[model samples]
Target: MSDPDADDREGSVPEAATPKKKKPKKKRAAEPSAGGVAIRAVRLSRWYGKVTAVSEVSLHLGPGIWGLLGPNGSGKTTFMRMIAGQIKPSKGELTVCGEAPFANPNVLARIGFCPQEDSLYDELTGLEFVSAMAELSGYDRVSAERRARAALEEFGLEDAMTRKMGGYSRGMRQRAKLAQTVVHDPDVLLLDEPLTGTDPSSRHQILDALQRRATAGALVLFSTHVLPEVETLTDQLLLIARGQVVAQGGMDEIRQLLDEHPHHIRVQCERPRELASRLMTAEGGIVGLSFRGPDVLEVHTWQPDETYAAIGRQVLESGMKLRSITSPDANLEALFHYLVQRANRGSGMGADAGTGAGPRLQSAAEKAAYEAQLDVGGGR
Candidate 1:
């Protein structure tokens, strides 16, 4: 489906003025923190016979929230399965809590995983099933019961805890699944689309719980194709494409990858006219300069880093102090969308595959499905 917030292409690219820099080699994922790495994948690769699902993905996750972002069929699930021990990597190593995760009970206790697929028995009540899982995690019966109650309460599922899994609404069932995952108080939480098929209130509740876990020092990783969800939950990002780690880092690092990128920076100063004229001649990377308003100039630059530094230097040299300078174009969504478009083009994955599938335009049925997911406050 075409995103309503898709970029407006009309007069988007600014005229080039400053020379672009020699792009740096993409940085590899960093080593885990000393507090201890929650999960690690080294040269990890997986394949389904002749088709490779994930390829040479190496990442070390530290304590905090990280969003696994990608379009559908971007090898996100395969990579997560490898980390969770549900599926073994065809090559290389993946470890959770410094040990191989596959069938390792000790390592498993450190993890709380909520897969996209439901795995609850129809006859069992939410409370009974989760309490049982908590018990199996090695908690005593009393402790398990208490933990289940607390988790259910946090998810606002206390009232429905006794409801049979078969009769629960999709939103209620999702809450139950989330409660079960956290029942054992695992150190690392891997949630795959945990907010899918929920009302706005439920989605907000789940996001609160996830944020609480991250604040409590757990490594919380969740996957979602929804751009706004990622923007809201975490700025720490792991952007994957076609089974490869295309870009992985904080927001600023990701933005640096866009070549010949021009961004509009709003500058408020004592002398706007003087600032614009001075910026026009500055060397490192000045693309364009225009008056945004009475006391602000919107400067466009190819090398933001260099131009920003140069602007500071000019201010000092001229002994002029500006009130404010902000880059409105340097945002997470724009950078992410640019990267995805570039990846799609480089991979030659059919021009219309990401949003439009064929020349027949969007059908009402597909738009209805998209709107339905949105109305439910779910970004699946």
Candidate 2:
């Protein structure tokens, strides 16, 4: 991805112009009780001339790790920037730490922002770059260097600390960026795709560090389109699509909201026609059914549990051979597609017709299934 702040980094802010030290950091308010709100947005919107990057959206988040999920150009970045106080909202209100973030130095100081794009000073070594950011966060020179080293070590970037960012690979640069974001130990961290391009070890370290921060009462919000990545970190998610908030809550909560939609399941069997015929005649939950090929059947049902039980009974009674059963809409990617399609349909925008927008999901199970099919067909 191209760096979004490339131009701003070239015209760097002078050290002397950085915000001066304020009063000793105030003790943060007590952590909210269950269901408390840490960040609140009321009809928030952002626009650049005629382009509306974020539509009116309202949300309430508590202190915890949250996955901000959306597709490319879905306004996740724009919304994060607005909350970080990097840009003013064009409409409505957004508050962090109980105060509007725009131009609020006190609030900004308590907020750590890790942007999606590379915003490093290539000429500076990793340690120096992070130390600079810590200093800008109001830490003195000695404390800044100490914190910088600690943060780099936390992200397993100690070996690369002395290397100039210009010489760092993509993964190394990503870790360096993450290290700086948490160097000052802010109360709220807005991380934009902080794990992108990182190796498995680096990803583990980064997630562990974020988990520690959340345990200490810091609200960590990280954005990514990868479903498995989100599953690894947190259950609380804020899903956005087409510049709007589509849904928010745990996986189960979101799924409950989607209970009205029929679930699509794909089945492969030795006698698909017989299985389909028996299922269609025996089931009450089956809403739709079709044959994909001679040995494959696609079934849509509103009550999946009941339908599956029925399928098992039918197979046992008829002595039919069964191969495998898979639900295509059982993962986050499918939920996202269902919500986006619903949103589009509600707005009179034909779901898959007007906007070329649809859910893109490639889960581990899906990939394995595809590979198995390839092997069976002698194409592997």
lDDT of 2 at 365: 71
| Candidate 1 lDDT (Cα, 0 to 1) | 0.71
Residue-level lDDT of model 2, residues 1-380, one tens digit each, is 34322332475423533443233254233233422226777557898998877876666676789898877877899999999999999997788888899998777777889999976788999999999999888765766777788888888888989989999999999999898889877788999998889988888899898898888788899998678878878877777777777776776667766666787888888898888888888865999999998989988998888888887898788887889989877677888777777766675221121112122215767534433322111000
Model 1, 117: alpha-carbon shift in Å? 1.9
Scored against the true structure, residue 314 in model 2 reaches a CA lDDT of 80
Candidate 1 on 1-380: residue-level lDDT in tens?
34211221242212221121122243221223323546766557899999877876656676778888877888889888877889988996778778888887767777888888866788999889889988787655665676787788888888889888888888888889899889876778899889888888998899988888788778888988666777788877877777766666666655664454576678888887877777778885777888878888888888777888888887777777799999876666666666677676774232122221122225777544433332111111
Per-model TM-score on C-alpha atoms: 0.68, 0.79
| Candidate 2 displacement at residue 234 in angstroms | 1.8
Candidate RMSDs in order: 19.6, 12.8
Candidate 1 residue pairs that clash: none
Candidate 2 vs. truth: CA RMSD? Answer: 12.8
